[model samples]
Target: MESHPPAGGHSVRTRSQHQRRKRIVQAAAALASRGGVEAMQMRTVAERAGVALGTLYRYFPSKMDLVVAVVGEEIDLLESSIERRPPGASTPASRAVDVLMRATRGLMREPELADALIRSLIMAEVQTPFGDRMTGLLLRVSAEGLTLEQASEEQRDLAGSLASVWVQELLEMLRGRRTYDQIQRRIETAAARLLAGI
Candidate 1:
């Protein structure tokens, strides 16, 4: 039996497909920076990426998909940056806090992009693959930066939970509901409590 290639004529992505995907994501990010996610219409993205409108849709079915892809790419870049930095302070809590702060500061530098990505994340349902991926990347990056030496299972779980809370604090700060100092206080207090039992 012969199976025809999927709609795109290839089951796996070719180099050109990869390039087109990258270009589309970059276009989406550029549009987001210029005027946030609302500015990222399918037509505008296709025009900016130099791909057919249908091709863009083939890659990202909707604005939400594009936003999530863009956010995922941005987070990948941030993860590389996080990995390259030297280890932080001595304790697991402080090291984790430092990593969280760096991530927050990076987002603060690009308020519009941050808002667009975070907005998409908020709109995405919890069970969606995009939301889960975004959340998982955040947790992995934060936990990777922590200094968990011979940590018990409970402490390891606490570190991951703390990472999510740190990300939430960042979103709150981005929304202008909380000052950076306030976020800092909240995060520090929470991290302290999480580590107290260790």
Candidate 2:
């Protein structure tokens, strides 16, 4: 008898590689949540992820690279939530409000964790490529589930600006400088206004 090649040419090693990367990211997230981003060393993550130190470095390459990947995953989760919301059931403005509020609430739900990530991004501690990738992800997600052709260039710019404002305001709220209720009200109001002109 002869052994056959597996589907997609994916041997056991291939599957293990995928799993190792996933586990490393999951372990990093958990550790970051508990002790903040500084605690997510490669050796520490490898130990928690049940992989060898070399495996962790092979998967992540660098701390900034790993964090940028984490931010990308976070954006995907947020985008999924926004995409799943029922836009047809209400006015576009209302749908936009819902999206902004949902994102704000999610940030509030993980104040310290978010602060750590944002601080890394803003301080240029992360590699510029990954930081640019994260900003692109934000633009993609914010523009998703929207019909932008109807809007003018200025309108599009305004929408993007409002999104940045909303994220910044949420950061302030996370820092305890503003209340959640205040952020919610301001975001909803701004989203509604921007959507109207779009």
Relative to the unseen true structure, what is the C-alpha lDDT of residue 163 in candidate 1, on a scale of 0 to 100? 65
> Who wins the TM-score comparison?
1
Model 1 off-target regions past 4 Å? Answer: 1-12, 126-153
Best by lDDT: 1
Model 1, span 1-198: residue lDDT tens = 474322221244577777888888889899888777778888999999999898887877677877877776777776677678743566655655666677678778888888888878768653334433333443343455323444456756676577667768877877789987887788778877775544
Quantify all predictions' global Cα lDDT against the true fold. Answer: 0.69, 0.62
Q: Over the stretch 1-198, how does candidate 2's per-residue lDDT look in tens digits?
A: 374322111233567667767777788777777667878777898899998776666666667666666665677787677557534435555555566677667766766667766666565554444333333333333444433554457656666666676768866875788887888788778766765634
Candidate 2's clash total is 0
TM-score of each prediction: 0.79, 0.72
Residue 62 Cα positional deviation in candidate 2, in Å, after optimal superposition: 2.3
